[model samples]
Target chain A: MTAASATVLITHPTGLHARPAVKLTKLAKTFEAAIRLRPDGQEGWIDAKSIVKVMGLKLRSGSRLELAAEGVDAPDAVAQLRALVERNFDENV
Target chain B: MTADTVGIVIVSHSPKVAEGAADMVRAMVGDGVRVACCGGNPAGGLGTDAARILAAIEEVWSPQGVAVLVDLGGAEMNAEMAIEMLDEGRGAQVRVCNAPIVEGAVVAATEASAGSSLDAVCAAAEELCQ
Candidate 1:
């Protein structure tokens, strides 16, 4: 099984705080794939499906993130997550 | 969307605190998990009420189970009393967790929304203190 990955810039003014982190984790739960994320230049990837872990990233606006998903729906998971990031988690900036 | 997941209740001395904590949990878990808030005295004072806690528990009751996150000392006692007020069968499915109200509620709600068992949800909430 191949892993699908994408690099996205955090656009939400507050970054991956509580609200956006919740959105990210909730969306990640919808797919069967295992999702992992890390700051663009960071070394470690954390479980994207865990709200606490996602919030711990403390990503700020303009911080780039690398997301990877592995499983049957890896491609779909990666695409949807990328779209969510691009949409700023649908929150007003 | 109900997947044998545990439910959550927030008990606080102030109504706003409970509601705000519930809001945070809702934001994290979305609409899938059940969450309820119980706060303030019956007279609308800054104190916990057993009746209100009981109502909140009933509001989010589920066969899977319910976890109550409380703030302060009195809140826990009221929460326990509220659980005891339930019928034996229903009461058996409820637990008052020892965790920070806001953080525990969020963690518990997140775990519950993922269809976690009652024990798992409680464990997740309790783990936040570590």
Candidate 2:
């Protein structure tokens, strides 16, 4: 609803692999918003709604990212996303 | 060994693709185990409805347990939901394994079903990723 709720981006050295991407997609689906991700200098946003699209980014750790969620749940979406990246998707750790 | 009957469900963007992958693996194992493919129009593709796929998994395993193998990401979600449903419906008697549909996965699933424990089946699947 607000520009402040557009989206948030985080990059992990591991990038978003199978497990983390799965978690993120599931969480994103809970909110009434459209989510997208842009991996540093890449044109066009990737659909965060689709796990395949998110995985297609092949993001690795240290890759700066741009995450944007537009909708009533944008803020929450961004918050959760930040948490997920901060945890490095908890990949088998 | 009490003759454990393990079931497999393969989901992919295309039904034929899933079937083809299964067929390739079956070529090596034959009909020794119960293998089912979900997805694709003709195969009735588990209907994007998690419950539907879960029902199919339950039906396939019935009194026993099943090890589910799904292709791609969305199908994995569908598989996860199916496993949860089956677990709730059948309890510990029904189980699910998340494994790739690649050559190694196919080989491991078939071998594990032959005599290995569910944990082993899962381990075999994990080995493929390595």
Candidate 3:
């Protein structure tokens, strides 16, 4: 598969918390796809697979984020990514 | 030895939580001291196995004895398990203190990087208990 991907807007009120970022990074690394997180208005892309990078963003709840995944597993990756975020990182919605 | 840097381990149920704690530490201390973290799973994650966490702890503690900070009760269990799994020699160098990870990470990263001792880090954590 060509590097397929999708970007989802983060709608959780808390944007993303540390525990959630760690969960996202941990899940993201499970697939062959490369994940990059671009915080709103940020010039650089952080490795969504890196816990440090995810937490470094310090995203507050309700921030809009773009999650890009590329590689053979990009489809499943995108689906799972949406599930994780939609689950509000397993925190209360 | 007069310490130049300290090794820190953060434990939480979620790896992200632990990493988030470390991120805060990095902001306070920069790249001076080494930091590692592990999460406990009901089933467990791929690299989050016991061996992996123990190795992460040993890797960071290569320079000096490590000071462990735990976020939750389970974190304390994982830290102890990591220490127990260490080689007798390596295990001797580990110090798993019941310090406040949220507070201790900030203080340890800042003070330890500034040449503070593990005792000082523990003291900083103790202050949070009050």
Candidate 4:
């Protein structure tokens, strides 16, 4: 199985709030990877595909995040999730 | 609405509240699962109605099962009444979740869109109550 990881910054004004968290989880579900995330300084990881877990993180704007994935599509999953965070989940309008 | 994904219903005393919760579900989940709302009495004021709730359930009926999120005790009671009014087999596929209405519905809808089972979707919504 392939593995991939990324470090990203939450740049959205509200960080990973409801809409962004939902989008992130939904996008993660499209992948065949088992993905997990942790805040830059946090101790444990949360499932990247679980809306409840993603929202529970309460990640705020400017928070740095660490993501890891393992599976056939791990590399693509990590890359896309990193881009989503960078694009602020496309909320800038 | 995929037959493999669970359905969702939002029940609230106020029409706006139920619709608002349903809107949140739509915004979050993008309609992968069927969702319906029942709010206010037949007169359209702020109140719960079993008949209206029943119609909402049927509106989003899916053999995959449905998980209902209610805003208040009356809404929950009316949802229960609506379920009881259903044929026994169909009623067996529904559950009234005990959780905060908006958040619960949003999370439950996401789980449903993820193709979670009926019981899993209900549990996802109820988890917020703890």
Candidate 5:
């Protein structure tokens, strides 16, 4: 199986705060793929489906997001999550 | 939505603390997980009430099971009583986790939001103690 990956920039004005973090984790859970995320310089990847781990990352606005997923829906998971961040999660900012 | 998630109850000596913890859980976990809180005595003082805890469990009752968080020994005792008081099979599925109220509830609810099992959610709360 091939792993899908993408690098995107977070443009959320407040970064991945409560709502955005919750949204990200909840969306990750909807997919069958195992998705992981890390910041540009971070050496460890965190489970995107876990709210605690995702919030622990403390990602900020303008941060470079590195995402990768491997599983049945790897490609779709990476694409959708990338779009979500790029669109600022539909937040009016 | 809540059917697949484990339920959570926050038990504390202070009503404000219980409500505050529940607020944090909701803010972080969203509506995917069901959570209820009970604190303060009937006299409006610092104490845990078994009746209130029982009601809180009922409020967030889930077939998937319920995880209860408490602040101190007294709160734990009362929470256990409340869980035992649950009639029928509901009591069997309810658990009083040995973890801090605020942090445990938050982590447990977070795992529950992901459709984790009752044991998994309880384990997540216990992991915080380590």
Candidate 6:
């Protein structure tokens, strides 16, 4: 199985709140890859596709997160998620 | 009015609570689900109004049906009464779900956005109880 990963900074002023968490979960569900995310130095990763889990992370602005995906579409999943974070989840930074 | 997308209504004694919950659901589901909020009494006090609840149900009514989430107590009774006030055929299309308002609305909206049936939406919302 292919694996891909990226470390992204949370740029949204409010961080990974409910709205962005929902957007991330929705995007994660569109891929076949097993997506997981954790704080840059966190011990364990949580399923990125679960809104509840993602929101529970309570990532704050400027927090660094590591997004990892493993599967046939791992590379694409990682790239898309990275872009989403870089874009500030399409919300005003 | 999508054939398979069930709508949702949130009922609470406080208008702010109902509207805020609806906002949260909309944030999760985007524009894909129909969500309405009905709160406060006819006198504009902190109580659930059956007429207001009925109007909310109608506002989001779809052939697929609607699920009502109430914030406990008289809110549930008002929701049920609102459903009963509808024509028999239409009333049968609505359900007063025994679920927490905020969490239930979020779950129900997400499920309905996926084109789930009324029963499926209610079941999804009810899962929050577990």
Best by lDDT: 4
Model 2 residue B107 lDDT? 44
Query: If both were scored by lDDT, which would come out higher, candidate 3 or candidate 5?
Result: 5
TM-score of 1: 0.88
For model 1, residues B1-130, the per-residue Cα lDDT tens digits are: 5737788999999999999998887766689899999788988789999998898888888899999999999999888888889997688899988789998899889878888789988887787676
How would you encode candidate 4's per-residue C-alpha lDDT over B95-130 as one tens digit per residue? 998888999999889888888788988887887766
Residue B15 C-alpha lDDT in model 1? 92
- Candidate lDDT scores, in order, read 0.87, 0.61, 0.68, 0.89, 0.87, 0.86
lDDT of 3 at B110: 49
Off by over 4 Å in 5: none
Off by over 4 Å in 4: none
Better of 4 and 5 by lDDT: 4
Best by TM-score: 4
Write out the backbone clash pairs for model 2: A7-A68, A7-A69, A8-A67, A12-A61, A13-A61, A14-A61, A15-A59, A15-A60, B15-B40, B39-B45
Q: Give interface RMSD, every candidate, in order.
A: 2.0, 13.2, 12.0, 1.3, 2.7, 2.6
Give the Å error, residue B31, model 1.
Answer: 3.3
Please give, for residues B16-78, the per-residue lDDT of candidate 5 as tens digits: 999999999887777878999989999999999999999999988888899999998899999
Ranking by TM-score: 4, 1, 5, 6, 3, 2
List, residue by residue over A1-46, the lDDT tens digit for candidate 3: 5454555667677677655665676578678888787876678988
Candidate 2 accuracy as lDDT: 0.61
In model 4 chain B, the worst 10-residue window by lDDT is: B121-130
Model 2, position A37, has a per-residue lDDT of 82
Candidate 5 TM-score restricted to chain A: 0.95
Docking class of 2: incorrect
How big is the positional error of residue A60 in model 3, measured in Å on the Cα after superposition?
A: 23
Error of 5 at A29 (Å): 1.1
Cα lDDT tens digits for candidate 3, B1-130: 2245668777766777878988887654457678887765647652234565686686677445677777666566666787888876777666766556776666555445545466765655555454
